[model samples]
Target: MDAIDLASLLCSRLCHDLLSPVGALNNGIELLADEQDPDMRERCMELLSESARASANKLKFFRLAFGAGGGFGDEIDTREARTALEGLYGADKRIDLGWMVTDEKMAKGAVKLLLNLGMIAGDALVRGGRLDVGAEQRDGALEMVIRAEGPRILLDPKLREVIAQGHSGGEVEPRAAGAWLAHSLASQAGGSIQLNDPADEVLLIGVTLPN
Candidate 1:
């Protein structure tokens, strides 16, 4: 409900995600310093590169997801959102993305909703299945849909509740910050976020914002 709390939560979430890759960077540097074997040295360098890339990807994704990206404007290029998401999950090579957006420009808050909702749905794909992100104008409203399907899907009960409805005055946590933000933004725009009842293999997230 407050900007300060939301900022702190998002910061914690970013730090939590970056920890592994950044820690890998440190370990890789230490290994490189101690290794003398040519093959081991090469492996260390490779590890360093991989860790750096991972760290960069996470930052890029967060920049768009949680920050006022590129400017102070109310709208942003939709392609940027797609690229940010692809950067975040593309390297893993597990989940396949099906981007079905046709709009060139979208309200910044709308794009943020899509990005965060996509992140939550994608996380549910424990086995890294398919993620389909689609958005368009319908009946003078902007509709965003994100569907995640995999062999096994696991969604946190609290997250499911928070995304579709709200915290209901409950305490906020770092992991749910994105979903919470999406919900808040949608409400501010006189819109609502929704979630389909989880099936055996699929989870669906949807949002609609006023024009």
Candidate 2:
């Protein structure tokens, strides 16, 4: 994909993800303005707070995953990526997170790839589940893994195709932006991605990027 098309797709994906929380924020504001009951107003305040938090978390995540976030640096603090993921996925408590990254910092490309994979895996847990993420720099390469296990996993075939392979034959869709980003980053770095076939209750993604 060309730069312009890729950017547009990423932007579309970001807007779609943020629409719900942002719309909630607007609704909360409108409700708070008209409500006379103190209790109802208090509840509105809570809704606004939650919506704002969600919006922030999603922006932070997309910033790092799809934009030039983490400032000017070859490596980014792993803590930032962890916080972004936890903030985005841990808010609802729908999916439990198990983090086992051993590196303090990793290449920015690696970090982006890792976050995108985590997001995709987490979304596959249709019935709520566990998301385990790990990364290590060894043997002169950065190796990362994201595993999702739940009662019912539903990974879209299009996403699977984009994640395992690039947009080789057809136009790229906005929903596949994240997957495309992951695949592109890996390929650009002379790396590779491995995706396990969809099974009863698990999805596994592994990436290796040479340093």
Cα lDDT tens digits, model 1, 62-103, are: 998998877738788888888889988778889999999879
Give lDDT for model 2: 0.91
Checking candidate 1 for backbone clashes, the offending pairs are: none
Best by lDDT: 2
How high is the CA lDDT of each candidate model?
0.88, 0.91
Q: How much is the lDDT of residue 200 in candidate 2?
A: 47
Candidate 1 regions with alpha-carbon error over 4 angstroms: none
| Regions more than 4 Å wrong, model 2 | 70-72
Clashes per candidate, residues 3 or more apart or on different chains: 0, 0
lDDT of 2 by residue, 1-211 (tens): 6878889999999999999999999999999989999999999999999999999999999988998984739888999999999998999999999999999988898889999999999989989999999999889888898999998999999999999888887888888999999999999999999988776467999998888
